[model samples]
Target chain A: MAWEARSSPTGCINLLHGDARNSTSITVFDAKGIHTYQPGWLYVPFGEQDPHKLQRSERRLLQRDIALLSGDAGNVVRIDPAAKQLQTADGQTHAYDYLVLATGSRNAPEEVSGFAEGADHFYSEKASLALEKKLANFTGGRIVTGVASVPYRCPPAPLEFTFMLEASLRDRGLRGSTEIHYVFPINRPFPIQSVSDFVAPLLEERGVQVHTFFNTETIDPEHKIVSSLEGEDLPYDLLVLAPPHKGQQVIIDSGLGDRDGWIPTDHNTLRVKGYEDANLFAVGDATDLPVSKSGSAAHYEGHVVAETIAAEVQHRPIRELYHGRVACFLETGHGQATFLWFDYEHPPKPPKPRRLWHLEKAALNTFYWQLIPPGRV
Target chain B: MAATYQIDKTVDAKGQTCPMPVVMLAKAIKDLKPGQVLAVYATDPGAKKDIPAWANKTGNTLLETVEEPGLLTFYIKKA
Candidate 1:
């Protein structure tokens, strides 16, 4: 079996390496050589973790038997699924027996007017480092943190960042003098009802102002005001917005994705929906799955897809199926954390925040590369 | 009144968190014969609801739920 996997360093390829290394020949295409632990970005702005520690070389993470195509030769330009071929930027064409797309979503701060110039975000390494420096400055006035659109990766990230920011300010003796506001598009603090029930009171008790139903429209950088579609304006001396996200542009160029560049994916099989019989599959944030665009979802989906593909290669029955399972940890600052775990039929009921959970989250971060990329745990 | 049944297997997921308990249950139940019973002990609060939900979705029978100090035991019969 010959497999063609395209994306930045993704969990799917890693899982494929582990599952089908003997029966299948796997080739991964990724122009970018660096892979970052994205969840660690939230801790960067708070000075809790170093941004440099979050990244690793993509080549080093893969097994030696797995082929990696990097640089311009690895940059996929067009994918002709009908022809079962992929054309890279280097003018090379490669055919595949099967294809798996893991081209994850990217932050589109430019989608919101003035957002690129006005807001400091923690979605990328450069942006996170810049925000860390900006946050380290002495004074604070009005700080606002929220999102610009939905379907963003890690739904709890903005909220967790807000909580950690408040704690950081308190530690710096700026809590009393500074005003912190949280703006959200929905009516609740979080999309999940149980999690929101636990978080809302904590926000209130901490005196963090909440502005619900405030969808960010534009930012007036000159006056430091962010206007919402709901005919409201929030003024802030420092603004941090979780930029809107969209699927990769290459997906759009290939005409293989929806308007937002997300591929139509089968929720259960993790296969590309329209071309189900074509041996095409999608995973991670690139898929139009009604689940959080978090690494945990990708990891779970990766396992299912890897198993299905490996079984097909071995002429065995495909027994594995995805149940929309996702698990994520929410950091609530002050060394306390909680987690959410649920699937298609079940909704998440977050447990009470505990210091032990926080320690567990930290431990996971420490062993992420060893556990996830190797498919060891 | 304490109700008892012959437990074919007991999975002690004690001190384990979400996903682990459910994942362990899913893996353990696959080896059981039809009508065989599997018991799981967990400490995560979310497991109290998750275990039952998992049983319902997997078409298994949740025979009983017993709660003690910092512990939860779920009895599930394979479908």
Candidate 2:
């Protein structure tokens, strides 16, 4: 929504987008090789091929008027009590009246032994395509999916991936010959009790073996085995792991982030903790808020932050507060999806899997492409 | 390349990157007649690929492309 607020006459705007550019299209495109793969329903809205009959549309961000700077932020130092400036890696400096740190988290594969070399990750654009190649060649084997650590982006994604993989295998006629194992660090299938209760039977019915409390300690690449911290060793022919997550290094280097690199901000106001000035706001995965680090959560946080900033600019009373809202569509194979919407006050009691939620998932992607990036909210 | 057809409207999407150029083109084409040609001038490296892909995806007819020193121009007819 940074682009939408640029037209405000309150002040001139300069938006600094970090150097890294990622496209989810790479994942969607590579999924063509897998059976029961939907293109536009995943992440990015770009349309090319529709494998699983996903809705397609023209949705993209346009930042024509917003002043943009693309580079790595080397340091963010407070120039004065009311002033802060960021120096880019290229030696350029930028001063800001209000600083919003939205630098997302990164995956740390090196934390696990052989994880960097043995397992394929679907988190990154490059790794997703690489995993697609691996998936295309696999005929039948034990496919193991596991989470390396807790508090990762999109908590339900690994579950969704596991489910989708089973669907794809069935579609390719490999279900009878292959085994699907989902290894999660948590004791239950899902964090929320209601969700776990709802999904456990469904997973059992689907024949997906759930291995809980399987905190990955190391992976023996040569033997194709994953050893958990609790002395459980699981063997797999193909391994897809969700690696440990860490906040951006720049945030840590600037002293604005905690030891693990996440910025501690007020959950409701999103204001930085130590900063004397309330102008320092943070949103998305970078914040140490007790919420799921998902794009939908970030989008909701964006609304609160945008409203707060606009109010500050217009000299109006700042009244907006974020309620830790989150909404996500869990894509279960067979052309159906379940909807989850909850907040700090409301725990998730997701509805039953329905085909309509699949449409809702598609609709959100359209909304994300059309409104989210443009700052329309 | 020289222009083969008259431009009905021009969206100077120069200095803009992916999504913006196509987004501007999408918005600009909405006001044009069905057969009217809209020209988009852009400097974003991705626009060369993104614009054509967008036109193809949206069923718009790409009439011609003109290459310049620092800018790339595409004429798309609303479909």
Candidate 3:
């Protein structure tokens, strides 16, 4: 059984389904009927992308040979890995020979006091659209954008959003009047050292206030102030935060995950640590790997998992292994972008931002559905 | 004359980009015994840095590199 959160399961199914010789039945259990291209949500508030265009029926993106269990029947309530069976919310029991958990992480605004009511975010479709309306009505004041916690999906998203927001404000003639404060929990602007070196100066040049080591402690909606654990208070007319994230609730309830709900997974093998021989694997944000939880990471891991499962089923030697490869295009605003590619052993050395890379990123967005899930690229 | 190592496996990654070239090399090298040599051919410029980094991280020995006009061939010994 394949679970859904991001595109990992879909990519895995595409590879496995393409093999005509392999007659193994593929089934996907997804409660959400629509699959959203999450990265596009960054552009939704800026009116650069329509939220509708970023989504498609999950059934349509999948291969015809695969069976899809959606709605309540697809909502997995419990996963009994010891029994090698799954129980759904619809009161149905299903057994599987191999289980791949791709149920990704979720934004947990409730983790921070008053965060859900005080802050606006672009992590979800509803939130992005809501921010769009709020941005449209904005006049000018203090606008704060930052992360509430660590290990969130799309590690570069907060930086990208900040840059784009600055550009958007300038275009709307609100740049001079508005103060953009970019906050980070860590001392650096980015997790990767080289990338931080490249970005820190850029933010400084833009006059974007940088607040490092500011872990959000609480938000006062009435006073419109965000306080940090370090005893610093920031006043803002508009608050945008990349909320704290947690793994799927079902995994936590079943005692399969850590206190934060992240599954303990083998870094090299992509297998659930203790369930290595049980034919159980965790991909994307479902695993507690020391890697960025981005769609590109998921795509690469999906490829390896597919190959590993395929080799096992064919009684062949499994050779494919995950090396924590992640590639992302960072938009630096004003129609220019930079590229980042790195693995577990190497750090990223991002080139100077260029218009060409931005165009390539736009092109990738246009062909995402065609090239990504089908593993065409 | 320098002694030459015999190639036990060859991975053609001439047209691949970042990650794929190294990914292919990793997969092919796994099938070889320790001390056996795996040859990887690539055109992606990133391979020059990535292949060696991967070898160093995985504890493999990069025996030699043959660079032509448009292609690079790397011979790595499994460690």
Clashing pairs in 1: none
The segments of candidate 3 whose C-alpha lies over 4 angstroms from its true place after superposition are: A1-8, B1-79
- Residue pairs of candidate 3 with colliding backbone atoms: none
Off by over 4 Å in 2: A1-62, A72-83, A276-278, B1-79
Measured against the true two-chain complex, the DockQ scores of the candidates, in the order shown, are: 0.01, 0.01, 0.02
**Candidate 1 TM-score to native:** 0.81
The candidate, 1 or 3, that scores higher on TM-score is: 3
Q: Which stretches of candidate 1 lie over 4 Å from their true place?
A: A1-12, B1-79
**Which pairs of residues have clashing backbones in candidate 2?**
A1-A375
Cα lDDT over the full model 1:
0.82
Candidate 2 lDDT tens digits, A23-87: 10100001111111222323321122232342222111223333333223222322232446555
Best model per TM-score: 3
Instruction: Fill in the DockQ of model 2.
Output: 0.01
DockQ of 3: 0.02
Give, for candidate 1 chain A, the lowest lDDT window spanning 10 residues. Answer: A1-10
Give the candidate order by descending lDDT.
3, 1, 2
Give the per-residue lDDT digits (tens) of candidate 1, residues A249-357. 8899989887779888988998897788889988888988867788888888888888899888878899899999999989888889898899877878888889988
The 10-residue segment with the lowest total lDDT in model 2 chain A: A23-32
